[model samples]
Every structure is written in C-alpha cells, then in structure tokens.
Target chain A: MLDFLSEFPSLGRRDLSALRQWIDEGFRTFSRAYGEQLEAFFNPLLRFLVWFQDLLTDAPWPLVILAIAALTWFGARSWKITGGTIVAFLLIGIFDMWEDTMATLAMISVATVLCIAIGIPLGILMARWDRAQSVITPILDVMQTIPSFVYLIPVVMLLGIGKVPGLLAVCIYAIPPIVRLTNLGIRLVDREVMEAAEAFGASYRQKLWGVQIPLALPNIFAGVNQTIMMALSMVVIASMIGVQGLGVPVLRAISNQYLALGLMNGLAIVALAIIFDRVSQTYGKRLQAYRETGRD
Target chain B: MTEEEPKVRIKSLYKIFGDTPKVALSHVQAGMSKSELLEQKGHVLGLRDINLDIPGRKIQVIMGLSGSGKSTLIRHLNRLIEPTSGEIWVDGEDVLAMNDKALRDLRRFRMSMVFQKFGLLPHRTVQENVEYGLGIQDVDQGEAAERAKKWIDRVGLAGFEGHYPGQLSGGMQQRVGLARALATDAEILLMDEAFSALDPLIRTDMQTILLELQEELHKTIIFITHDLDEALRIGDRIAILRDGEIIQASDPQDILMNPADAYITDFIKDVNRAKVVRMRSIMGPAAPAQGAPVAVSDTIEEALQKLHAAPDGCCPVMAGDEIRGTVGIDAAIQALKAPAAAGAHYS
Candidate 1:
C-alpha cells in the first residue's frame, strides 16, 4: 500500500524504506529515553522502609508499650482509655513479647499520623472545590481498591526497602477513608444554616470557618478514626516491605514454620490494634458528644 | 422615596435563581419586568420585581402563603440572595450596587436576620450562638458577652445561656435566635417566621416577647409569615403577597376589613375579623370627651370587660390621653353578640 501510494500523483513521495528506517531509529531512541533502569530506583526507599520495619521489630518492646501508654493517657484523659492502655502495656509485658508489640505500635502510629496529615488537607480541598473533588476522588478510589502488595512493588522500585517506604505505602493505602469522609462532612452542612450565616453578614471565609467547618467536626473526626483503624490494618501488610514489629516476627516465624513465635507475635499485634482502636474511637466519640452537648 | 428619606427603599427588585444569573440580569435590563425576564429565560421567578418602601423603626409584616416570595423579598434586603435586576436604595444608597465588602458590612452592621428554624449554630451554646454575630462584628469578648447577656435576659433566657440549643425547647431556641439578632443591634431586622417553629403556646410566648422587644427598641422589622393571624396580630403594616406579588400593603385593619382581592378576602375570611379589627372599625368618629379614654390598643374583649365594669355604656378611643372616637355600648354589645352568634370561635 505504501509503494502504490508513492506512485500516485497526489501522494507526496512516500518511501517505505525511509519510513522503516525512521521507525527503527525512533524505537531505538524511545527505548533509550524511557527504558527502566537496571538498578531499582525504589531500592533505597525500600531499604529505608525495611529499616523502619526493623526498628519496629528490633526496638525494645517495653519502651514501645510504655510510649503508647503515655500517648493514650495524655490524649484521652479518661479512665477507660488509660485502663485500655494499661491492659495493652501488661499484655505485651506479660506475654514476654514486649519488643515486637512496641515495634508494631510504632509502625502503626507513623502510618496513621502520616495518613491523617495528608488526608485531612486533601479532603478539605475536595470539599472546597468540585473540580478538585472530581480529580482527587478517583485517585482515592484507586488507592483504596488496589491490592496492598502493588504499593510495595512500586515503593521497592523507587526507594528500595525500608520502614519509611512501608509506612508511606501504609499511609497511601489507608488515607482515602479520612479524605472522603471529611469532604462529605463539610458538604453536608444544612443549606439553611449556611444561608443564615450569609444573611447575618458573614463573609465566605467566616461561614466556612465559623459555621460549616465547625459543624463538620464530628464527621471529620469519624473519618480520622476510620483512618487510624485502616492504617492499623495496613501495618501487617506493610511488614512485607521489611517493616519490623509483630508483623516482621510473625512473618519470620511463619517462614521458618515456628508456630509458637507466629502465634505470640500475632497476639501482640492484636493487642496493639485494640489499643489503637479504643483510643481513636474514644476520642472521636468524645468529639461528637461534646458537639451535641455544646449544641444542646 | 421621599426627600425626607426612609431607611430602606426597595424598588422593583428582582431575584431569579437559575442558569447564568449575570446573563439573565442583562436580559432583564433590556426592558423587562422580573417575571418577563424569568419567563424569557425559563427560570424560576423566585421574586417578581417588588417595589416597597419600608419605613424606619416600624414592624412591617410581609404575609404570604408558601412560595409567595416573602422570604425571597426579605432576603434581598440583606443580599443573602442577590437581586437579578432593579434597585434597592437602602437609606438612599443602591444596595445591589454595593461591593462585596460593603454589602457584607451593610448586612452585618445594618441588617440582621432570624430564621424560622432558629438558625443557631449547632456547635455553639446559647450564649455563643447569641454572641456569634457580635463576634463576627469584632466586638470584644467582654462587650459581646455583656451584650449577649443583656439580650438573652431580655428575651427571657436568663438562666439558659450555658445550655446548648438542642437542650432548649423550640420556644427557647427561637428566643436564642431573637437574642442573637438583637445582640447584633442591627437597625433592620428580617424575621422569616422566627416564631413559626414553636408550638402554639410557645409561639404566643415568643410573640409577646417580640412585641415587647419591638416596643422597647423600635427597630425597623420586615417579618415574614404565612400565618395571617400572626400578621394581623403583630404587623404595623402588612403586605399581603401571593404568587410573588404584593396584593396589598396596608395597616392590619385595612387588610382585614378591606382585603385587596378574593384571595386575600378568603385568607382573612375565617379569621374572626371582629376580634382582629379593633373597636376603631366599629366606633363612631370623635365624640365629646366626658371620661377616661381607652387606648387604641385595647382589644374588643378588653373593651367589653372595661365597659361592663363602667357605669357608662360607652368607651372612648383615646390617643395620648385624648378621646379620638367613641365605641358605643350598643355597638360594643352587638359586636360581641355577632361573633358569638356566627359561631366565629372568637376565643
């Protein structure tokens, strides 16, 4: 077809040989320009994430448990959270799995905090603009639905294995719940209430800060709580990326077919999960109740 | 519109909410009334071009059934909803022409609103809700607190300042809302059925509070309500609206005694017009003064009670302690007898 077109009067001198040559050269340059590096770009990051994981597994279990106990005591300021924290403290201390438990808690904390810090602002931006919401919502969905292992592959490729990379992957895996919830919360402010603020001479910023955002606090807190739980869930998966803590020991015990080690580390992870869940849930409940009481 | 000038001069204001408000407005300016422009653009004509002159320091009720544009009209005064076209000369300045900041300043400083649902901030306590606007105005905490305390007490919520709105009854919530609007101390008050959310008894209680507040402060008020009884009971001048147009804007007695059309007549028909219409409607013109004078505010029931106790079978309608007219004893009795005979349910 190319040779026939070249012979036609209207066709401007099409040449198959030259075209083939151009295609070959273009393919060569394209491969040269865009081919993957032999060295995994994520190796350093993956290594760092694994170090983070190791820190979790290698840290003194007693110290890790004590830190969590202190955190809940300060934040919740209630007997229930304090009691739960103590139970978490004793469970690790008594089971003689204190080191692994501490490691798990550390990993989960970093993952959850990072998730929240990024998630909340993104949610606020989505709430503030429909275009941003449309663009970001699909990305959040992708983050939420894709298998956890997919995250590790890319992290390992770009940054190498580490505690940081796993934590980063864990955050990416868990943050959507918070962002989606935050956006929904802000959007759900009563239309009449918004109108009242405007009628009362409140500026756009005033309405957002004074009325809409404040009303949305309970919902946003719920999102944050959900994020915490999700981040906790991702801790185990993240351990695959060289994350330390209970996951590392469990994985080690599993690979070596040491049933007792696996069971003990798993139990320690469960304890950490319960502590994280209770504290986050209690704080979120406190926020909701305070709002109701204040409004009432 | 007078040279002496009223506080708010709303002339041919229009608010059509749909598709390209700017484009709709430009089309309206090309020689079309609000409804015509709305029809031309196939938009919901929320507010027809309404020209109203609200006087300073008077309680003017904008009465209408649902979807009658009473709320829409009042909302325009504060620019909570901007008018598509037409001029709102607020104290001789075109309100629609004010820039964003100036308009907000106007709304915050000069016009404040109370909603039917008691639009208190749900995250705030009664005290905070009352202080919300004051805070927005940059009033110092102490002063805002002081002002909030004063109005909260004035609205008879003296002990409930610390309580949240959800803890308060519907009436108390409305009171908090009123106190919030009052705390702002804005001269123009736009009340969109502020008392309607309360039960009947609580509504009456809030009504009395509002009457007292108006009497004391004499703030110019634009009150919107679908309840005709509320309008007749509270309004200094009532504008009867139907289908986004004012049918009549007159004194309550004028609206009750001589309603504008069949619709308004039906609206006032079931109302015990005799009870709502004062003795002035039944009384003879100024008679020779002989005894103590009854103020125009005295109700027929009150008049009946006062006349029954009096030896004389007559009561004089008094203004500033002078007899303006005489409501005869026979006339009073007949006025009393007629409603009772009509199964009017005057009570």
Candidate 2:
C-alpha cells in the first residue's frame, strides 16, 4: 500500500507510447487519403496569392507608392498619414527590402480578407443563436490558446510546407479576434433600436444589412485591425514552413546570428503595422462621428 | 359615442412572461394573482384578460404607471409582444393568425410605431431616417425621399434633414420619430410613450403637434402614457391599468366623475380636476341661463373664467348650435372641489 501510494497508479509508458503512435498513424492515413483533394480545393487561393504577389512586385515602385498613398488618403483622409506611408515605403525600398515587403503585404491582405469573409458570418451566427455561440466559443478558445507550432505540425503534414499551409496557419492564428469582436459588436447594439427596426417590418436580411451591419461597422473594423496585426506577427513563423516574405530573411538572420538583418526586417514589419493600425482606426472613428458630436 | 365599428379589437388577451409560459399561463387563468404567480412560478404576468375596442379616427390612451403593462398591451396590437393566449382583430382581420410574411406586411403597410426613446438610426440623417419606413416597403427611392421630405417639413424639421439624431435635442429626435412613423402612410399609428422622454415643456409642445396632426389626418392612433394630465389632454378614451389589469376604461370625464376603484382614485388624486372636468359633465339638463354661452366641450376652468366675467354666475352649455344644458357657479365650484375618493357622488 505504501509503495502504491508513493508511485501513484497511472498508464504505463509503453501504453502511452502505443496510444500516441496509434493517433499518429490514424492522422497520417487520413492525410494520405485526402491530401490531394484538399490541395485541389485550395488551388484557387494559391493562384490568387501568387498573382497578387506578382502584381505588387512587377508594378513600378512609383506607381505602387502612389496607389498606397491614395488608398491611405481615401481611408484616413489625413495628409499626415498618407505622407508617412509614402515615406515608409520609400525607406523600405531604399533598404532593398521592397520585394519581400510586397510579398508580406500581399499575404497580410489576403489573410485579412479571408478572415473577414469567414469570421463575420460565423460571428453573426453566434450572435443570433446561443447554441452556436456555446459550441464555437470553445473551439475559438482552443485555436487562440494553443501554441502556433502545435497546429503547424499537422498543417505541414497535410499540405507539406507551402504557401497554402502557411496561409492557413496565419488565418487560424488571426481569426479569433474578428469573430469575437463581431459577435460582441452586434450583441452590444441597443435593444430598443433593434425592436424599432422589427416594428418597422424590417425582414431579417433588411435588418442585417441596413441596421445591424451599419451599426456594427466600427466594431467590425476594430476586428479587422486586430486581424491584420496578428497576421503580420505570424509572418516569421509562417516563413518557417517555406513561405516567402521579409520573414524569410528574418528567419535567416535568427539561424545565422546576424543582428542587423533581423532588425531591418523587424522594423519594416513594425512600420507596416503602424500604417495599417492608424488608417483603420481613423476610418472606424469616422464611422461613429455621430456618436461623438451628440449632447446626450 | 357613435355606433361605428371599432378599428382595432382586442379580446381576452393574456401575456405570461417566462421560459415555461404555457404552464404559468394556466395558473394565471385560474385566478392566480400577479405577485403570487411571480413568487411561486417565477413568471411575470404582463397583461391579463384585456378586452378593448378602439374606435377609428380617435386617440385611444392606455395609461398606467411603470410596470403596469401599458406598454406591453400596446405592443399586442402590432404583435410586438405575442400574447400567451388571446385574439387581436384589426379591421375585422385576425392579427394573431398572420404568417411571417403577412405580419411583416401588416406592420409595414397598416401599422407604424413611434418609440419613447425616439429610435432613430444613429447612422442615418434625419431625412434618411424618416424615409426608412418607405424604403423598407421597396418604394421608389425618389418617391420615398419626396414623401420623407414632405413629412420632414410637416414635423418642422426641414432645415435639419441633414443632421444626425445624435446632434438633435430630445424634442427634435421625437419629431424625426414622428416623421418616420407618419412617412409610411400607414392608417394606424402606435405611439408607445412617444413624448414621455421629453421635458414637460417639450412634452406639451409635442402633444400639441400630435393633436394638430391628428386633427387633419384623422388616423387611428393608440397613445400610451403614465401621466393622467397627458391622458386627459389628448385621449378620446382612456384605459387605466394597474398590476397588469385594467382598473377602469372610459371617457376622461367619466373616469374623473366616477373612478372604478380605490387604485384609480389614488392615480387621479393629485390631478387638477378644474382642467379636465368639462362643462358637459357638470351641466344641468337643457335649460335657459342668463350669462354668455360656453361650449359643452369647454373645461370647467374655461367655463368658470367666462362665467366669472359675465354679469350672471351661470352659463348655457352649447353643443354645436343648440344649448344642451346650463351650468351654475355653485355646480362648477362643487365639481372642482370634489375629492377624488368621493368621485362616485358626481355620477
């Protein structure tokens, strides 16, 4: 009895190893059977990412700079932000990081678009039904709290270290904020306001598009901003699995102990993040301009 | 007073609020009190055995304090809150039997509501907000805008059409709310404490505007309020509710002259009777009198003012072109001085 209490009863090491092996074999078999089909399903996304990256890299530097400045101006309507963005791009170009920066930008943009497209609907579903919220919330928790490398192993096993798998990993990392915020934003809409829409005979689609979506825009934009930041932060980890970006050189610097190379690429990433954050936040604030001006 | 058909009829309506409403409803139907049901079954009784027939082209006021279910009762007309069991007939059609599409159509085209909180879309400008009801019905955009502009002008909000609701005062927001509800051209206007959020001065101004609009439009209006003064001011008929049950429902003068019970008497105890008691209630049978004639519709205060200025202390109460009765100073004084607890003596 004393020996048993001291050791504690547990599964034997051989049994645990066998159980792990069994799970590993099951996943490998599953991936072997469905890998080609899954790859085919993601072909369009792969093609789109390649085309976007090529477009950014092949376009004249001046033209790209001008387009980004115009977009910044349109979104933020601030001369300071537009000027700062132009200067940042010029600096990145001077540092000979233009090609990698464009690649990273393309990846971040596509990741953001995909996350919004999927996350918003899921968030809306969660807001509308308690059961959907109950089920999805825990899944989101697992996706968020689980270490990036843990999911990377299975993702790489299935897709075998390419852009599509890397993109999937970034999306999984960045999607939770958008979904959670969208649900919260929609739920936070005034109850009386929703009732008024209902009393006016607004159908479900009408209420969603006209009232709920418009009112929730600021929150959705916040989610989008967070998603972009998270996706940018994942660039280096994503590059570990054969994705190309500034992250590639950063990874090289890390492995070779080259401090200057890592710092340059890291600063480029930080600049991009600031530009995205400011522009999106400014646009979100403008959407709620009415709220700021009212007396009571 | 005419024998015309009622525009909206509610029969034996009951509303129990809880997870298991049907079970709670059984207890309420069997004469369980509201508090008892709430304590024992954890269910709220929202409304109980409500029966009312609202006449067309008049303001029907549902009056009660907070939590008395006056708001809940008005929502039943538009089916905003579904009854636990009852039937609501609007224009002789069964409202409760409508499918989703039919219900939407009914709300979109036949009934429009103004909210107490002035539920204007914060994202929309006043013009767009007013045009919302029209837009929902898939009306042509230009025509909807035109109609919306007309109402914006009518509600005295023409110059402020571009301003957002947040920029407006409470009174102005409600004007936008009124404009939005009226823009649909629906026949029934359901105002759920529409002016209760405004200051007293703004509330009276809104009341006057509503009355002025009702005079020209002659739409069937259901107005809900807690203030007895507001009910007496605008209601063609008033129903006083207490604890989810209607204690009394009648013409304002009838309620003033003969309260149904102690609860109603308490509700009207502080009301200034001189303002609400009309000459028609205190007038004697058709008889000749010496002073200048006062309209039967005039309040006792107005009649007294005229009677005091006349050489004689009596006045003839005129109903249209004919004198229906006479009112003396002594009777007017008695009417004004009568205690609410002893209101039955007047009847």
Candidate 3:
C-alpha cells in the first residue's frame, strides 16, 4: 500500500507516449492539408502588416516623431506628457534604436487594433449570453495562462516562422485583458439606465451604440491600455519567430552576452510602454470628467 | 361628468415573479395570500387581479408604499414588464397582443415614462438626453434638437442644456428626466415615483410644475407616489394599493371621506384632513348663511381661515355664481377628525 501511494498510479509511459504521438501526427496532417488555404486567409493581414511597417520605417524620422507627438498631445491633452514623449523618442533616436523602435511600434499597434476589433465583439457576445460567457471564459483562461511557448509550437506549425505567426502569438497573449474588461464594463452598466433606454423605445442597436458603448468607454480604454502593454511585453518572444523590432536586438544581445545592446533596446521598449500607458490613462480619465465634477 | 370611454383600461391583470410564473399565478388566482405564495412556492405575487380604467387627460395617481407594485403596474401600460396574465387596452388597441413592432410604436409614439432615479444618460449632456427619445424614433437631427430645446426650456433647464446630468442637483436631474419624456410628445405620461428622490421643498416645487404643465397640456398622466399629501395635491383620481392589491380607488375627496379598508384608514390616519377635505365634501344642503360665501373648491383649511374673520360661524359654499350649500365651523371641525373605527385589526 505504501509503495502504491508513493508511486501514485498514473497513465503508463507507453500510453502517454502513444497519445502524444497521435496528437502530433493528427496536427501535422491537419496543417499539411489546410496550410495553403490558411496562408491565403492571412495574406491580406500580412500585406497590411508589411505596408504599415514600411510606412513607419520609410517615413522621414522628423515626420514620424512629429506625428507621434501630435497623437500624444491629442490623447493626453497635456503639454507635459507630449513633451516627455518627444524627449523619449529623441533619446531612442540618439541611441541609434529609432528604426527598431518604429518597427516595434508598428507591430504593437497592429496587434492591439486586431485584438480590439475581434475581442470587443466577442466580449459583447459574452455579456449578452451566459452560455457564451461560460464557454468562452475557459478558452480565454487557457489563452492567458498557458505558456507562450506551448501555443507558439502550433502557431509556428500552422503558419511557419514569419510575421503572421509572431503577430498571432502576441495577440493570443494580449487579448484576454481586453475581452474580459469589455465584458465587465458592458455588464456593469446600470440596469435602470438600460431600462430607461428601453422605456423610450430604443432598439437593440440603438441601446448598444448610444447608451451601452458610450457608458462603457472608460473601461474599454482601460482594456486597450492593458492590451498594448501585454503586446509590448511579447515583443522579444515574438522576435524569436522572425518578427523584426527592438526585440531583435534584445534577442541578439541575449545570445551574444552584449550588455549595452540589450539594455538600450529594453529601455526603448520601456519608454514606449510608459508613453502609451500615460496617454491612454489620461484620455480615459478625461472621458469621465463629468462624473468627477461637483454639482454646478 | 360627461360619459366617455377611458383612454386606458385594464382588466384581470396579474403578475407573478418567478421562473414558473404561470404555475404560481394559478395558485394566486385560487386565493393564496402574498406571503403564503412566497413562502410555499418561492414566487412573489407582484400584482393580483388589477382592474382600473384611467380617464383621458387627467392625473391618475397610484399611491403605495415601497413593494406595493405600483411601479410594476405602471410599467405594464407600456409593456416594459410583461404580465403573467392580463388584458390592457389603450385607446381601443389591445396592448398585450401587440407584436414587437407594434409594441415599439406604442412606447415610442404614445407613451413616455419618467423614472424615480432620473435615468438620464450620464455621458450625455442635458440636451442630448432630452433628444434621446426622438433620436430613437429616427427624427430629423435639426428637428429633434429644436424640439428638445423647447422642452429643456419648458422644464426650466434651458441654461443647463450643455451640462451633464452628473453635474446637476437631484431636482435638476429630474427636470432633465421630465424634459426627456415630454420631448417625445407622447400623449400618455407615466411618472414612476418621479419626485420621490428630491428633497421635500424640491418635491413640492416639482409637483407644482407638473400641475401647471397638466393644466395646459392635458396629457393623460399616471403619477406614482407613497406620500398621501402628494397624491391628494395632484391626483384627479387616486388608487391606494397594498400588498399587490388595490384596496380603494376613487376621487380624492371620496377617498379622504370614506376609506375602503382598515389599511387605507391607517394609511391616511396621520394625514391632516383639513388640508385635503374639500368644502364641497362637508357642505350641507343649499341654505342661506349669514356670512360671506366660500368657493366649493376650497379645502377645509382654507375655509376655516376664511371663517375666522366671518361674523357668523357658518358660511355659504359657492360652486360658481350660485351657492350650492353652507358649511359651519362645527361641521368643518367634524370633518377634520378621523372616521369611526371600521376594523379591529389595528390597535
């Protein structure tokens, strides 16, 4: 009895190995059959990603910096944040990491946009139905908690090592916060307010766009900020699959033991994260200014 | 009063709140009590056999304490809360039988409601909130804005149109709520405890505003309240509900003089009868009195004030140009006292 207890009965090694072999072979067959169609399905996304990266890198450096400064100013509405962002970008440029910074910025932006475009509707669906929530919540849990390398194998197997697979890997990691936050935000809308909309004969579409979505904006913006941060963190990991960015230098530095190279690229990523977080947070706060002010 | 059809009619209305409402409804119909139903079947009896006919263009007040289901009953008029069993007829159309499109039209074009919590969209300005109902109906943007502005001005919120509801006082937010409802120009206005959240002074002011608007608009209004004073002040016809059942419904003066049950008597026991009892209710047969005439419309309190200066203790009550009866100080005092005990339930 003691021996059995200590050993802990489990699947036999032969059975476990056979199960693993079966899964690997099944996945290989599926990929071999669907690989061409899957590539065609993602061609437009690939073209868009390439075009966006080219736009960021091929543009004159001054124009790019000015555009980022203007976007920061528009979002934060604060001169301090805009000035800090400008200085951060200039520092990256002076350190000769401008090209890599731009490439990473493009990648993170596209990933975030794609996540929101897909995740928000899925989140809304979850908020509408308990069945959908129960089903999707577990899948999102796996996406969020599973090791990045585990999913990387399947994604790489399906799409091969390139920008698309890397983008897919980053999105898998970054999308959960957005989807969860959006579901929470929409579900948290006041019941009385929604009833008022219905009492006035608002259609389903009207209630969503006019009342629910507007009220949920601050929370949705929070989700976006979180998604951007998670995407940025995945940059180095994503670079291992051939996606180009500041992650490339960091990866090189890791393999070659070059301290300066790793430090500069890592700091550039940190600077980018700070600028995105501050601008988005300030904008979110601005959206709820009405709630903060005292009665007139 | 001229004989005319009521604008809204309800018959055999019942509401049961639970997963198996139809089953619970059968038990309630078979005479199960409210608490008994809740205890035995885990179902709440929301309203039981509600039948009422609301006349056109009048303020019909439904008075009840919290949990009396006055809000639930009013929502049935617009079908916001579907009934377990009932028939609702508004202006000759069957409300319960309406399909989705018809119900939408009914709510959009015929009825509008003002909520107790002032459910103005917090993200929207007062102007945008007021325009919401019209926007839902697909009205022209410029036209909707102009109409919304008119109501915003009408409700005394013109200057605050650009402000968000969160930046306003409770009274101001309710004004926005009122303006939003009225801007739709729906003939039926349902006010579910619309003034209950305001301070007493603000509540009184809002009551006066509603009365003044009703005088001109003559919209068919259903007002819900827990305060007897508010019901007496504004209700053309008052219905008193308790435990999901209406114990009494009649003219305001009739309810004050002749309460239908012990619960109603207890409900009105603390009310200052002099303020609510009209001279018309207490006046005697048409007889010449040795004092100045008082308007039949005056309350007992107002008549007493007038009698204080009269040489004689009695005064003639005039309906218009002619005396309808006389009311003496003794009769006025008698009217102020509570009715004789009608039930042994209350100590």
Candidate 4:
C-alpha cells in the first residue's frame, strides 16, 4: 500500500508553474482594468469614514460622554448598563487611548455599514434562489475558513497598502456572519405564515418588506453584532497595511516587544468589544421579546 | 345547485406531487396505489379526480382525517396549491384560467382565508393583522382601519387590538384571523381548521361565534375539519374525503342517517346521533292529524324533547312554519339509537 501510494504520487508534485503564472497574469490584468473604478466607488465611503472620525474626536469630551451614555441607555435600557458604558469610556480616557479608540470606532463603523449594505441583499438572494445559494455558499465558506491575514495579500495586490485596502480587507473578513445569519433568518420563517401571506394575495415585494424582513430583524441584528465584533478583531491585523487606530499602538508594541503598551491596547480593544457586545445583544433580545410575548 | 348556481365548482381535479406529476397521474388513473406510486415513481397522489359544487352563501364543510386531502382540496379553490390538472370555477368565472394578477385580485377582493395555526403576523398588532386583507385590497387607510375595528369588535376582541398575536391566547389569535378574513368583505370565506388549535371550550365558543356570524353574513364558507360533530353542526352540505378522494358528498343528516360506505360509516360511528340526526330525517309522510309542530331543521334530540311535551307522543315537522311531515316518538327514539361499529379501521 505504501509503495502504491508513492507510485500515485502527491498532488503538489504535479502543479504546473506555467498554470500558476497564467492565473497570476490574468488576475493582474483584471485588477488593472477594474482597480480605478473600484477605488472611485469606494471614495464616498472613505470620505464618510474620515468625516465620522473627525466628528467623534473633535466633539467636546463631556458632550461625547453624555451622548454615549444616552445611546447606551437606549440600547441596554438599564441604568447599570449606561453606567458601565460610561466607565468603559472613562477607562479609555485614563489609558490615554481616546483618539486611537475613535479611529478604531470609525473604521469599524464604516466596515459594518458596508458589510450590511452588501451582505443583506446577497443573503436575501440566497434565500430566494437555490442557484444563488449554491454559488455563494462555497465562497462564503472560503472567506470564513481562510486566515484573516491571507486576505491582506490580495487586498495589497489590488488596492495597495492604505486605510482603504485595510478597510476592504476587514470588510471581507467580517461580512460572512451577517450574510449567513440573514439567509438563516429568512429561511427559518414559518412556512405556514408564508403560505398565509400568499393566500391573502400579498405581492412578492410586499411579502418581503412587510413580513419576511420584520420577522427576520432579530436574527439580522444578531448578524450585525457579530460583524461589528469581527471587524474589531481585524483591527491590529488591519493596521499592518497602515490603517491607524488603537491597532497602531498594538502593532508598535508587538514590533518593539513592549509588554505594557501591548497589554494596555489589548485591554482597550476588549473593553470596546464588551460595550458594543452588551448594547447590541440587549437590543436584539428586546426585539425578540417584543416579537414573541406569550412565551414568557 | 337548487335555486341558485354554486359559488364554487370544481371538476376532474387531480393533484400529484413531484416534478413528473403528469406521468405519475397516468399511473394513478390506471389504478396504482398511493404507496406503490410513491415507492416506484417517487410521486404522491395528493388529490384524485375530485368533483364538487359548493353552494353559494352556505357553509360547505369538508371533513377528513389528516392526509385525507381535505386541506389540499380547499387550498385548490384559492389556487394556493396549483392542481396537476383541474378546472375550478368561482362565481361562474374560470379560476384555473386566471392570470397571476387576476388570481391576486380574486384572493384580495373575492375570497379570504382563515388558517389553522392562526397565521397572524407576529410583528404586527392584532388590529394590523385584522386589517391585512383590507390593506392588500388597497382600501383607504381610514376606511380599512374602521372596517378592521368593526370586525375585531364582532369577533369579541375589541380591547385586544393593541396586543400582538404572540401576546394573545390561541383563541384570541384565531379571532384575529377571523376578523382578518371578515374585514375583506369577501363573498367566500375559506377556513382551514381555524379552530383546531384552541382548547375544547374555546373551540365551541368559536364555533358559536362563526355560526352566529354566518346567520347574519351568509358568506359562502368552506370549513375544513376532522371533527364529525363540528361538520354536522355547521355544515349545510358536508363532503367527506379519504386518501385524496371524495368518499361522499351530501347533507349532514343524510351522512348521519345513511353513510355512503364503510369508511364514512366508521367516521360517524362514534358521533352523537341525537345531536346530528334531524327531525326531517326521521319524519314519515305528512299526516292529516297533528298535534304540536317542530321545525324540519330541528335535531332528533330537540324533536324528542318536543314529542315528550305532546300528549299523543307525535309532532309534525314544519319547514318554516308549514307542516311537511310528522315524526312519531317511536321513530325519533329509533333514530336516536347509535349504530353498531361494523368496519375495520383503515390504516
């Protein structure tokens, strides 16, 4: 059996260098053709991110803290949660991580919005058509299973090293959860309910907007939460391509082997994650409770 | 079919489930068994050559056990389940020939349905759920709200309008389902086991509500149920289905007095005869001599109660105050006796 295995040989030994060269050449040509237009398309989004960052950092610290407290109160709907959110923000201030945190926040916000804008419709398409599901499912699997660092190579090749490339790479890494959740949510809607809608003669558009989306909101929000978390996780990795944030300090600490700086930045990231996580998860739970009241 | 044309007419309806249904239909028509068709051809015979005429403004009850295609047959009337091959006529218009838009129009304006599980939109309030049909029909916002509110009140769910379906009890949710259907003001109302999810007491209350509303509205209702008693109580004409075929179609009194075959006989064996059997069914030819009078529509139990009050132990059966025939105490008592169970249970 061992002799026969050697006789069959390994798949790696059969690779053609010419085939690899041709594929790389083809990709380069395609990238050359589409790169400028893609960058132009992303210009508005990039501008929005810059504007958001300025807004967050330029505001008076007291007003920004008050606004954060208000948003926290709205999202978690508890005084304890609002107090926790304020403490988390105050810790960033004490650590002197405020400006870097704002940059990370802006980058994550842009990446999340982009993911939702792209992921939801694609997810709906997957739910609507078997063919679309079949086509996109494998791609999503690859995106999720591959190492996040591996995406940087492709992003560098296409758009080069910058905040835009870093943002795109983070979005690519973060989008799968929202897409998968959206598709699952729509598919999970009760079949009898869908039939009832059809029997009542609802148009396809009406059925989608009126029934499906509203029912799927809780799941979709869960997806958004997961996307935001994933985007935040990509922070330090994204900083490798010159995206500035708390990740920059983390990257600097890593290169210099500075323990205090690395630990402080890492803890700041965890703090941000906890605040975002609590608010979003609480809101999602509230929506689910609102939808299913008799259960309790 | 008597004085007025039927509100719905179905002819030669055949529904087979599979991609190659036409091929499977041929095998089914050629007398292949349902299991044999499934095993050999991978297709299920959902409905077989069903013919029925549902009279206008009368409650036409379709009763059968689960998988008997009773639900399947009713769904065909609304084109919710497209038949493999069939003709459906609603109000003398060919339903099968209608395009998608026309079919939508038919569902929106001419027919409404109540679902078994109370298919209320969980995200919507009860008022919004009740208003769904009217909204779909493009009724004006204010007018639709008014009509929905009225039906909601009629269904005895006046204060629950602000509540969600998930917040309401099953019976209340079903009332919202009823209100939704009624608010459309559609001529035909199709209720597919609309009360099956409720508790027994609530189910009876819903039945009373439906019957009382039917008295006033007179909408052509096609009610599907597995309960024989419910069928007898509400149905003007009852059609029994088994294995995707109509076993019998007749008046409820006829079904109770003379079941078509062993299958239908078995279905009605456990039924309370005094409650189901009517005076008209037990009455003999009209006699010149009569004492008290009972309505022809009166049940055997009522007729017996009436006969007990009569000194001679006999009462004339009246059809709207006109004497048609007389039912004796002996005949009413005889009809009240339950028939012996004589058939093996079908698998």
Q: Is candidate 1 or candidate 2 better by lDDT?
A: 2
For model 3, how does the per-residue alpha-carbon lDDT over A104-186 read when each residue is reduced to its tens digit?
99999999999999999998998889999999999999999999999999999999999999999999999999999899899
Candidate 1 local Cα displacement, residue A292, angstroms: 5.7
lDDT of 4 at A70: 95
Candidate 3: the clashing residue pairs are none
DockQ value for model 1: 0.47
* C-alpha root-mean-square deviation, each candidate: 7.0, 2.0, 1.5, 2.4
Please list the residue runs of candidate 4 whose C-alpha ends up more than 4 Å from where it truly belongs after superposition.
A1-4, A7-16, A29-34, B306-312, B338-347
lDDT of 1 by residue, A172-201 (tens): 888999899889988999887888888778
CAPRI verdict (incorrect, acceptable, medium, high) for model 2: medium
DockQ of each: 0.47, 0.79, 0.66, 0.62
Off by over 4 Å in 1: A1-67, A94-96, A290-296, B1-3, B20-42, B282-284, B287-294, B304-316, B326-347
lDDT by candidate, in order shown: 0.77, 0.93, 0.93, 0.89
Cα error of candidate 2 at position B156, Å: 0.8
Model 2 per-residue lDDT at A92 = 100
lDDT of 4 at A122: 93
- Comparing 1 and 2 on DockQ, the stronger one: 2
DockQ, 0 to 1 scale, candidate 2: 0.79
B239-319: candidate 3 lDDT, tens digit per residue: 998888888999999988998877778888889998889999999997757777899989988888767666778899998
